[model samples]
Target: MTAGIDLGHPQAQAIQSDEDVVRVRQLVRTVAVAARLSLVDQTKLVTAASELARNTLVYGGGGVAEVTTVDNGRRRGIRIVFADDGPGIVDLDLALTDGYTTGGGLGLGLSGARRLVDEFDIVTGSGQGTRITVIKWSR
Candidate 1:
């Protein structure tokens, strides 16, 4: 297995409520801008972060999101991880499907977020809560 590079220390934000989601988006946007990402890329990352943050608040019963600057020798990217301790997803495949939602939403949040970012990873079990990580590389 290829070893993961050491990304710099991450900045964390609490996601206990809707207000925290807004704060996350703002923080993501600021970091995206500071990284000199394109306007479109910045928006994509911010939008994805918003969706995941909301999921943490609504479905996960609140959580914490960690934001970090990543460098893989050749490229720089931003990685955001949303983690919660609430009940976890029951079906990983179904949850990632395009039109699957347990929250009466349009079912576009997770799939759409995956489309927006360059990398995505999720970990969850029936009662283990949920954790999602996404990254967008600078152009």
Candidate 2:
């Protein structure tokens, strides 16, 4: 059957929940391929995805990473968003800076993930929640 819908609608996929880390990795890889990202870019994307997934599980108790592909003319990129409802970050500024750890990472997950990708946005507050989005473009 044919489907009809009005304009001004957005189509998005909310990734599966089971095996969060593995699921995230697969999604990132798919996005990278669809975006025509290079091997280097794919590696970086996967690395960043892993970091965010870990943070969500460890700090957020449990969360899911959403993967989306963005296209702009000759440029294309993949965006990965990690969201959690668990305890939020108390100090965002301190947490972002290198060598800051509440969990047992080199305190580098946030910073390292940022370095691997092109754009990074982290929104977290005490009792509020956390949603981190990172993007890497193919060039």
Candidate 3:
């Protein structure tokens, strides 16, 4: 029902760097494998986790990511929760829209992440913090 993982970086500021993103991606893969996630499911989970991790570093200042495994009889799945206590998004609607971003490059953090996973939830408030959870089911 609930599972968690503690992600660390050399420095909080390093989160914005590509190197940090790579590190988080690696961690996501490892976690997926350890969770016994299927190949198809792994691909999606990893992508979603990567996107959420990048956002936490970029917008949330810095924090950790947690993956939860949920099994409901015939179906099994994993849920990823990215939490950070940084400056929160002021506009949730605008942030979820495609092609919207304050940073450079194609801003597909939310939409792209959503496409990769079965379910996605984001909670944030100004100066409060952010918690993004994405789930992928085994098929």
Query: Whose lDDT is greatest here?
Result: 1
Candidate order by TM-score, highest to lowest? 1, 2, 3
Give me the overall lDDT of model 3. Answer: 0.73
- Taking the tens digit of each residue's C-alpha lDDT, what string does model 1 give over 1-139? 1123547678899999889999999999988898788999999999999999999999999999998877777777898999999899998889889988999998888999999999999999999999998889888
Query: All candidates' TM-scores?
Result: 0.94, 0.84, 0.80
Identify the runs in model 1 with alpha carbons over 4 angstroms from their true place: 1-7
lDDT per residue for candidate 2 within 1-139, as digits (tens), equals: 1122222222233333447677778778876887689999999999988888888888888867777777545567777778889789998888889999988779998888999998888888998779998778789
lDDT of 3 by residue, 59-98 (tens): 7877877655666565666766788889888999889888
lDDT of 1: 0.90
RMSD of each: 1.6, 6.4, 4.9
Candidates 1 and 2 compared: the better one by lDDT is 1
lDDT of 2 at 38: 95
